[model samples]
Target chain A: MSREHQKYRAPDALDHTRELLGKLAREVSVSDWHLVIEVRPDDLPEVALRLRDDETLSCKYISCIIGVDYVDWMEALYLLRSQEHAIPVRLRVRLDRERPEIPSVTYIWSGANWHEREAYDFFGIRFIGHPDLRRILTREDYDTHPMKKDAWPHRVRRTEWRWEDIERPKRLPGETDRRDRS
Target chain B: MSTVESKNDAVNPGSPVNQDGPAKPSFHLEEMILNMGPQHPSTHGVLRLVLHLDGELVVSVEPVLGYLHRGFEKLAESRTYLQYMAMISRLDYLSGFFMEWGYVRSIEALMGVRAPKRAEYIRVIIGELNRIMSHHVAIGDFMLNLGAVTPFFWVFRDREDAMDLVEMVTGQRMMYNYLRVGGVRWDLPDEFEAGCRKFIKEFPAKIDEYEELISDNEIFISRTLGMGIIKPYEALDYGISGPNARASGIDWDLRREVGYSVYPEFDFDVPLGQHGDCFDRYKCRIEEMRQSVRIIEQALDSICGGPVNIKLPPMIRPPAGEAYRAVETPRGEFGVYIVSNGGLRPWRLKLRDPTFSAISMIPKLTAGNKIADLVAIVGSLDLLMGGVDR
Candidate 1:
């Protein structure tokens, strides 16, 4: 009935308190009948699996996965949804920026492959269990994570090159190569 | 060939694909790596596809993006809430209006605000109209991919009229950032409604003409009907939405499922496909355009008299919370996740860009597909690289 309650009530969210407490012994409650798992980085992968496989919390759809940088501490938020019940569970994991490594959820949600790559691309957070980690949406050679506060301004190249300057060369008969002959 | 000689003389071994002989091994297979473009015209934009090919057959494709990154999300972080609203139009420049509307709506939802009822109705109308235009270009590109250039011209002729109507309403034809935080930037002028009605009235017959020109053509059907198939289950697993998901027989549409704005009031059918192939996807989009016309007609009747925008401060600093709002754009489910730390600028703004997920299914879709089918399949996905590489 309350706004706080409506925030968690989508249609099918798992309220996993007893099971989460059994694993991490962290305080968990059912707000709007949806599970809010507040866990450390180490328990993330395991907790993710529990919510994914358990019928009551079959968070089959990984609706959204995001990362927040609090300078000293970084948090990865996984918003999982159940198709049957139509409820969404909010899984939050806090990690220290110095050692920003956590088990990947690629196995759980194939969609997370790109999402994790983006998080890693922007926040420099590493997903240890990720299958293929590459610099996506940015040049592979580009270094600084631009999303970071300390990042230098992105390189700017001002050019006055004309279209005539970049035309392809034509070839002549019996040429060593079209380019070479040119 | 003085031009040729001069061009070649000025170049180093800059043609990465041309200079490398047959022996230079690429990543996988015995296939050669063909760098398609950062310049080729058929690429649609400055896209480079690192194609691992065993002759004409594509062994694998590694699409390289960010040629048009422009750092849009990062740019939004520094600009004022109102100013940042303008940049969204350029993200998926093809589906410009949808991107702008989705972006503003996400910010609005996070702020726990809604546009006035009149604004919602207008948003639905223009958004649907934009969806029709986006689909026309997509259909055009898909036809062109299959080597039909005439259909591209034919579709664009109709598309141009749609663009004209859009121009009257929001001044700029293509990248109209007409949507504002609380409401639209401007209300519809008297001519705007008349122009739209005329376009909507004539659009159905034009669509029929398009079908007669190409859709039922033996060559078009043969090339597209069975090519590039991905089942419904696989589509859902890959998080495919919009036309791509609907093409695969999944009845998931954000407009119907979530009921974001006044979409609930409009009576329209959500078309489905039994076989998720390039052909079905193409059909789904065409049909969607038809449904969009109906929605426009219904919206036009209700566009009586009321405020176009909600009453909100010129500057918006939303509460410390986050909201993810997904919309059924022409491409697919265009979602925006906005996190506000009670600041003028969003603490975080990430998009569940349909093109990103749609493009991911490319490898699976194109696995056994021939080189000719490559462009057809790619165009059918109707990706916005700006959305993908953002």
Candidate 2:
């Protein structure tokens, strides 16, 4: 209820994971929320399997797969949770901006199927080996990933019928096509 | 054309199955593609399911979502931290309080601001009330999906009563943006206790009537029992939480496990089911409502007077860090992950909606079951499209 009230703490099993992942992973640190681990794009599948199968770090459930655009590079954050320990680990993978592709973890966690598709949909970050990797939460014809910082809002994009074309159609009294008005 | 003919010949070596002759097969099997809806009523919202069916049995179900997507994560990046609170309620309209609570709690953790004692108690009270309200809808809708219409009306009647009590304090019927970053926006109204007491007193009888009406019905049991059984391991592997996961025999409730807010002070039972079936899921929700009522009763008895909100500066700028806070909503574990950049706006905000993970398991749950069972499975899961497609 108050700031000083410390009701919950991460179990000792999770504390052991910090040390284990620190030894195996590229970089490991602990945050207020969860243990953060950084791994290369190629090692994601192997690390994901270890997180799911390892005795100490059996994070069978994946909460979310978030893709953040950091201007210089794109980062993918995989929030994994071990139901047995009630501890979560944040797996961060940095992808090159020019080729934002990483091996999909759908095989490890079937729940990651949609989350990967969502990441690909928003940031145009391709997930290699992902079956049916297509745009989700957006139309199939949408050319640009709207969540990118540099991408313009859909309303501002130029379409088949521009505002100037509509204005010109209104000015021409002889125009009878409804498509012109649209 | 040559490659297609060779492949056909390879399947039926000597038989003329593909040839236009009288030597046709005795029986034919075809996978029928059926589109359930982006407009169908049973989906609960704008959700589309592309069902691959073999006669009456479902072969696979591909859920086509995004019909209700509004790009909330993208919107959060452009708005200031406090400015995004108004939109949080819209994520899960049924349990708006939990969504608002999760978002604000994450920000509080990032900024090291703790809500006062009285505010925590108020949150527990309103949060339990909202839980009951949401479960009412879940039960009513589940029954309605099985062709019973009376329970829906009965549940809504009680829900309206609960909503009246919430509106008195929050001043909004549906979208109550009452939770601020530090604490709640307003203090409890003068008649808040009396109203909640009146509802809590009569609510148990209503629940009993609801159970007697449908819980024992032959049709309801037959439809729900032994259907969509999710094993404990499968539930955890798929990241199912709240009632759905508990019904599968997983005793992992964020309220009890994480012990956020004043949930630690209140003593209540986490009703779990033995066998993970549709009936168990239904029973879990029914029992959870009773537990919520118990929690509210205790919270009301122990609540004391104090400031509901903490004083704060005009602009809230949490230091550069990230925080993830999850709360037990009626659906499941609803969480908010905030990445602050020592600025007014969040560098990135991601919503970990429990329904999103629950819905992902649909293809596996619906496979091999009859087409009609799809509705029951989805209904028992208690998904919210607003949370799923967000």
Candidate 3:
């Protein structure tokens, strides 16, 4: 590996990032993969802008936007990478499960447009200022947010016609109803 | 749908019924909406492009995907880490090993296990060979899209030799579940080195023949020279990677940038292009194949015999932590992000497919260009819907 890469390593590489985000973010934690910072949903746009424009950070590339449903709340993780420092950081915003909404960072990084849409498609986490927040990986009329823990898998086909709606044959005097069998 | 039509009709008010009388006959040039395949041949897979056109010039292009969405991520949530291996190879069918490598590496990192030096070298060699194979298909299909049929045949014919060599070691042709968590599934076969050496020695001349046949052709040059130009900043902004990003004069390659696996020891150049145009993208892939060959030769010379796989329990339960590993797949930076909750199955596994970002830029690139140029631009991007949709 190059000397510069060896110099930064992982722990110290994002030390400055931790320091910078400490002022703007609610919490900062380092993981094996990246430096994670927790930000409020309302502060996501401003925090994302600073991470991209701040000279010390310069995280211009938005690698991905991942949504995880923890049952109680939904979390949105923004994976950001800096071309200048070759360091990656993850900024996370926690949302209410009842009404998950956060401002979109499409203005800061154009790459996040599709990823945000994908998160919305599966998790139903609405992006406030998104240009077009429609279903990306699912059909337009798909009703359920399939990636949520409580949501059913999209492959399960649901029929509109119920068994009760079907006309039953005349039962014999001693015969039992099919519904009673269950 | 109604809103979109009304908006389009309002902006482009040139219907025949609304035209002013005889003497000033205005051209009724309403915007045309064209759907180019979930079934078209040149799309390479089930990808649909909804194109808005004004007379032959493309006004906008929206890529409609998910025709092949099998819910890989949701499936991963239910299966064990090892069980998910069966599906990883199918992510990018053209280059399966790299996807396997990315997934295995992430788990290995979380588990804190390291592959031996020899196994690392083997991984590098096979990975580079897969890279060459993928580029062959890409360049071939790209040429075919541009109306050159002969090069496609030649390229695929050359790729078969590499495929046979890989099959010899992996025991399968395409979906080689050859990579495990700590290392490869099996050691190299007796003749693996000899076969690789012979192929490496012969591949450069085939590349030269390809250049002679297509690179300098006047028609090909005009069609590609300045087409689909993505500036360096625009490419970075869109998070494009691999040859597409390199063609835009970015000196970023995960092999060199992050230096994962045994790639740092290999001395090879990351080929770059001056202009970020279609021609530059083609040239970059061709040059990258040469670099792959160079890396393979060095790995073959320095590789030593050792254990291929490390011992582990029947089920692998990585520690409760998140691990993200990125590898330089032929398409671009294929990364696997795994969040482990100390269980047999992953809590969340997100595949950051490079094609996802690369294809996202298609709409911007297709604007103001002729419909014919759309094919060249999309072909040069070398997107696989399998990877994008997954």
Candidate 4:
């Protein structure tokens, strides 16, 4: 709650963010405040817990977690928040394509459970220590995770059988129905 | 707070293993793994929850997602900046206005552009109306989940009325992509004011109907009153927002705290709850709908006549920077984080679904409750799987 640049409290949120970040982590250069934490894969969950629990850094809320598939590795970016201080923290965890696994922070904040699961199911990142880590929003029998950049499904043409043509009656009960054959 | 410290007795304390094998020595009870959904109506979507059940009590819930993954973010990377606006509506199908508003606000923040005063007024009016509509459906769905059939019909009946009002203005019922980069797509039609006025005047009484029907019903209270209780500290820690946070006695609303657009111009109250529980969450929503009606009335009275949209170039390429915009959706705080590359397409676009935190709160809320209570807790969260899975 360090008040410095309260003018952009509502409007011009970016400037407000820059000033707040400057106040929080004094060592972080103002220029590099946007991309704050460059964390290793294994260290991410621990860092996240500290951010959520430590009184000095109670960033208890994870606003969003996104996964981007780059050519070399998959990048998982988390946007977190501290409503009391009105500050936002950005954390990144990049995993190589060969072995994409990271610990789950769902234990720290229960809200991260489904989000982490979604990231794992779609991006193919194995969430180590995730309780009941299973596919959620996908079809039960669907073979592939649709969002994975590397995987592509074989598309097939849809077939529809019309009932009118297939069940054409041979004889009508009364007068002969108009029969037109071409 | 420390009570939740999980014991290794329930699960193996050894290193996490990915292989399918016999139960380890540390594993005490043999838990049955069950797939909750793919087609089950309770799940609300194709969402499949892999559950480890110790009889009826759930030991763990593993959520599998991507059934409704339209790859919106991936698709946005290829599309032009302005074109991506249309796609935001599809991310959270339930509350499209918030999704659109969040994206536009982010773009405006990055580009340093502001909507006109009149446009801002309209934005508040329409956004609040959208909130009301969302709550209607949410309450209805919640009631349905609680095994209450009458409330769902009654809630949706009013929700349709709100949808009719939206359709008249935008010409689209569900996904009204009426929000533009700097403002709205069009001005409110002549009948729009009258329609809104009619709704605002009658909405309070209709809410009374909801109270008499559901709120006063002893069965509803027994199902919800004390179930899924959350404290303010826990609510904040878990990143719960909107009605969910308010139910926990947290008196914070982005509409008031953040005060984006012309929200400050209108006089309205941010509802708070004394106890955070399923009942409080339910009451918070009903009260919010009332507040929305009040806000709409104020905005309409102060609504000035002018161009609804701001003029901007067809191709939008903001300077290289990042912008994050948060809006109070019915579920919670809906945020959009966008990274611009000073090009037609954005470097990265991420949507923060409010339901994500609410979903995470599920285990906490339902851990000790009966199986029936779990259904009530899920409904109380009022999640949209589209946004969660997107």
**Best-performing candidate as measured by DockQ:** 2
Please give the range of 10 consecutive residues that has the lowest summed lDDT in model 2 chain B.
B21-30
* Chain A of candidate 2 compared with the true chain A, TM-score: 0.76
* Model 4 TM-score on a 0 to 1 scale: 0.78
Sliding window of 10 residues with minimal summed lDDT for model 1 chain B: B21-30
TM-scores of chain A in all candidate models? 0.71, 0.76, 0.76, 0.65
| Model 4 lDDT at residue A109 | 72
Q: Per-residue lDDT for A1-182 in model 1, tens only?
A: 32323433533332344643475725465542445677887888777787677777667667656777766678887766654545657787888878888889888777777778888887788999899888777788887877765566442221355555866666576666534443
User: What tens-digit string does per-residue lDDT give for candidate 3 at B1-390?
Assistant: 965665555555474534554333345466899999989877889889999999999999999989989888888988888889999999899999999999998998899998887889989998998999999999999988888899999999999999999999899888989999888888999999899999999999999999999898898999999999999888888989899999999888988878888887889999999899999999999999999999999999999887988898879999998888889999889989888899999988989999999989999998999988999999999989888888
State how far residue A119 of model 3 sits from its true place (Å). 0.6
Taking chain B only, the TM-score of every model is: 0.90, 0.94, 0.94, 0.90
lDDT of 4 by residue, B1-390 (tens): 332233342265442442356545543355778887767777776666677777777776655556677777667776787688778888788789889998998898899888887888887887888898889888988898888889889988888888989898888887888888888888888899999899899889999999999999999998898888888878876778899899888877887766777776778898998888899999999999999999999998998877777789989888898777789888888888787779888877777888767776676667645567777877787877888767
Error of 3 at A72 (Å): 2.8
- Candidate 2, residues B144-247, lDDT tens digits: the string is 88889999999999999999999998999878888998888889988999999999999999999989998899999999899999998888777788999999
Worst 10-residue lDDT window, candidate 4 chain A:
A1-10
Model 4, A1-182: lDDT tens digits are 21212412223234443444443332322222233455787777667776676564467767767776765778887777666655556677788877788888877876676677677766777889988677655555667755555556343211244445467657756656655432
Shift of residue B347 alpha carbon in model 2, Å:
1.6
lDDT for B91 in candidate 2 is 95
CAPRI-style class, candidate 4 = acceptable
Q: Report interface Cα RMSD per prediction.
A: 3.9, 2.4, 2.3, 4.3
Per-candidate TM vs. native?
0.84, 0.90, 0.90, 0.78
Runs in model 1 lying further than 4 Å from the true structure? A1-37, A54-58, A83-85, A153-182, B1-29
DockQ of each: 0.20, 0.45, 0.41, 0.27
What is candidate 2's TM-score for chain B alone? 0.94
